[model samples]
Target: MKTRAITGFFFIVVMVGAMLLGAEVFLGFFTLLSAWCLFEFYGIVCSEDRKPNKFLGILTTSTLFITTACYSLGWLEAKFILLFIPVLLAIYIHALYQKRDFPFNDIGFTILGILYVGFPFYCFTRLGYITGDFNHFLPLGFMILLWTSDTGAYLAGRSLGKHKLFERISPKKTWEGFLGGIILAVLVSLCLAYYFQTIPQWQWIVTAVIIGVFGTLGDLVESMLKRSLNVKDSGNILPGHGGFLDRFDGLLIAGPLVYLFLYLAN
Candidate 1:
């Protein structure tokens, strides 16, 4: 318990600190973070006989992320994102020569790593610079809402949970916990609306709702992945936190949606 708490504390610190540091730090930090998460995803899916072209996958993903970062940082135009296409195409071409039985399966999972893990993080970087100027509050607020929702659900579920939310995917989650997350997230959104005038009150509340719903979905999706793979955790890099994927799974699905909403909102 102490180890989990300690790891979580530092995790929060690094996350919050990176955002508060400014645009470059936020972009640089998350760029590496995106790559690490993709690497973990590949590790989970790959085996000896069937495996992704990890070198190409990472190269393609990193290219996409770096291009996204460049655009977000105003170093290049959005058209620079096209640079990822060639590297991505390289994945398919490279797979042909590997002579594996399930080459397409390998290719499919490689791309899945990008869509499932990489693209959302790309959207995440865009969120910080959505307004043409880097404002940390939007991205930071997203994390705060996600963390708050998770905490609320855990507490409420432990105390009042009865009916399971998705027993097949995640046995511990409950409908009661879901509602608890929504309620607390709404409350926190109100406070954010009060303090951060960049976004309207109703919008903040709506963002909270999005985080609660989609974030839980993200957690469940990752849980489903792990369960299918017959693994306990994604990895143990974070000590008690399992792995980067376990810690950031909620962000995976919720992030892209939030980015879309915020992009349209602005």
Candidate 2:
């Protein structure tokens, strides 16, 4: 318990600092994180008996993330992202030369990793610059709301949980916990609206609700992946936090949804 608490504190501090430091630090940190998460995803999904071009997978995923980050920062043009199409096609071409069976499966998993991990982190980068300027408030505020929701759910589930939210996928989650998370997220959104006047209170509340719902779903999705793989945790990279994927699963889904809401709202 002490270890978990210590690790959690340091993790929060580093993440908050990176987000506030500037766009460069934020992009570099998350781009590396996205790549590592992709590596972990491939490691879990592809067993030793069936290797899925880890080198190519990592290369393509990293490229996608870097591309997205550059585009988000206006350092690269929109057409540069199109370059990924050929790079992805190279996966298929490489599969043809390999002697592995289920090459298509390998291809599929590789592409899935890019979509699952790369695209969402891309949205995270987009969130930082969503307002045509690099404003740390949206990304930082999003994390605050997500953390609030998760903490609320855990506490409420321990205290007042009665009904299981999703028994098969995640047995511990409860309806009480889910509601608690949403309520807390809404409250945090109110605070963000007050302080970060760039976005209105009502929009923040709506985005908070979206984060609560989708963030829970994101957690469930990663849980389902681990359950399917028969693994207890994604990886041991974060000590108490399992892995980068486990820690950021909520952001993976919620980030994109929140980005969409902000884009549409604006």
Candidate 3:
């Protein structure tokens, strides 16, 4: 409880500061955080049964950092898109060289792991770069939805959770908790939507609806990864919470999704 409180307080302070400052600052900080998280994810994956390509890991992480830096400073978006092809080709060529044991699947896993964690996070830079009537609520609003949903799910699951949501991937998750989280997120979204007077209430409703649902999928994806890796927690950086990745996995997944929704709505 103490651990959670302190971490929560620090997280709120930093995020609030970032939100108040401006998009570029947030982009810079978020890029660093996402890079660290990517490195952590790759490290954890490589620790699993199959050894992932370390050189490829470094390459992907470096490319992602540079790409995000470019996007944050508002340059080379088209050029960065082209960067993906070379990554793919490198993975294939490396797979051919390391075909002594298991064949292409290992390389595929490395590629998927890197791209999945890296590219989606890059979208956050895209989001923060947007300027609009709502003071670029895209990033802030998504964080609110993700955090509130996570809190709701935790509380609901602890109190009244009876039915399993996904026993295989997440044994502790409950449908009731998931629904409760969505409900809570919707109410918060409605309040923020009204206060900001940005988009219509319907859009806020849609935002909360999609985020609440997909955010769970994001959590489950990481949970499944941990389970496959046969680990209890992703990492132990956060006291009470396992790691930054463990805590924000859902946000990592849902942030890009919410950004896309806001972009399309606008």
Number of the predicted model whose TM-score against the real structure is largest? 1
How many clashes (backbone atoms < 3 Å, residues ≥3 apart in a chain or on different chains) does model 1 have? Answer: 0
Q: Write the residue-wise lDDT of candidate 2 on 35-154 in tens digits.
A: 888888888888755566677777876777677678777899877877667777888999888878677788888888888887888888788877887889998999999999999999
Q: What ranges in model 2 sit over 4 Å off? A: 48-50, 72-74
lDDT, candidate 3, 134-242, per-residue tens: 1656667778888888889889989999999999898999998899899999999989787756667888888888789988999999899888878777677777777
lDDT against the true structure, each candidate: 0.90, 0.87, 0.74
Residue 46, model 1: lDDT of: 85
In terms of lDDT, model 1 sits at 0.90
Model 1: runs farther than 4 Å from truth? none
Candidate 3: RMSD to truth: 2.9
Top of the candidates by lDDT: 1
**Residue clash pairs of candidate 3:** none
Candidates in order, TM-scores: namely 0.97, 0.95, 0.84
State how far residue 143 of model 2 sits from its true place (Å). 0.7
In candidate 1, what are the lDDT values of residues 1-266, reduced to their tens digit? 99999999999999999999998999889989988999999999888655977788888888988887788777899999899999999888988798888889899999999999988888888887777788999899999999999999999999999999999999999999999998999999999999877788998998999999999999999999999989988899998889998988999999999989988988
